[model samples]
Target: MKKAYRIKKDKEFQLVFQKGASFANRQLVIYYLEKKDQQHFRVGLSVSKKIGNAVTRNQVKRYIRQAFIDLENRIKDNYDIIIIARNPVKDMDYHEIKKSMQHLFYKTELYK
Candidate 1:
């Protein structure tokens, strides 16, 4: 995902966490806040150190980002979304991650 399409700052993540509605499955958790003035959606990803070492965390993040990129066209545009990876995600592959994310989006009605 591009920098413009990502939530990179701590404040932004906190805003989403505090103000947004959340949805989750066993593998992933999602927090989303509608941003009516924004032209497109932006996403933030979180993978705790408790989930793995550096390489594993980075790999999980990459998978999540790629999943978002693939779903960009189908996802609602006027929201800020944050995805938090849970422990079960460490064993999941890219396809599984994507599917789990899709489930969250569908559950939240963010998927078009």
Candidate 2:
């Protein structure tokens, strides 16, 4: 994802997690909150140690970012979104990850 669209700050992640609504499946959990003043959406990703070591976690993040990139134009704007990887996520390929993510986005009504 682009730097401008990526949610990098600790506070931002916390704010989304605490205030945002969330949806989850076997692969990932998504948390999102509307930010009407913003011009675009911002996204954050979290992969726990239980999912894998550093390398696997990074791979999972990359997959999630790629999925977001593909869906970016179709998603509703002006929201903060966070994706958290679950244990089963480590075994998923890019297509599976993308499918899981798309499902979550739809469930959250973030896809426009």
Candidate 3:
């Protein structure tokens, strides 16, 4: 498990948990709340069984984590980004997955 602050119990996460506002040509339900003493950003990958079995879900999580690692060096900001995996992601390639996250950050104005 990743050692980082979790938004699991945060009110903002729950409030923005629903499908709503979108950006980067993608429909993302984002909750942007501030965090102090957060030395780094932590990403939470949310994969549901509706997308696939345990293996498939874990694969997506791994892919998301790798994508984050690749971008972490270039990414600048403080956030607890939780990516909810959509069914379409199961068929998407790594580049697409990476771009989706990068776009999300860009759209959210999290990138400097």
Task: Report the number of the highest-TM-score candidate.
Answer: 1
What's the lDDT for residue 90 in model 3?
79
Ranking 1 against 3 by TM-score, winner: 1
What does candidate 2's lDDT look like per residue over 28-104, in tens digits? 98999999999999999888999988999999999999988899999999999998999999999999999998899
* Reference-based TM-score, model 3: 0.74
- Assess the local accuracy of residue 70 in candidate 3 as a C-alpha lDDT between 0 and 100: 80
Predicted candidate 3 versus true structure: per-residue lDDT over 76-103, tens digit per residue: 5565566777788777778888888887
Clashing pairs in 2: none
Q: Rank the candidates by TM-score, best first.
A: 1, 2, 3
Pairs of residues clashing in candidate 1: none
Q: Which segments of model 3 are wrong by more than 4 Å?
A: 5-31
RMSD of 3: 3.4
Reference-based TM-score, model 1: 0.98
Per-residue lDDT for 1-112 in model 1, tens only?
A: 7889999999999999999999989999999999989999999999999899999999999999999989999999999999999999999999999999989998899987
Off by over 4 Å in 1: none
Model with the higher TM-score, candidate 1 or 2: 1
Q: Each model's C-alpha lDDT? A: 0.94, 0.92, 0.65
Q: Worst 10-residue stretch by lDDT in candidate 1?
A: 103-112
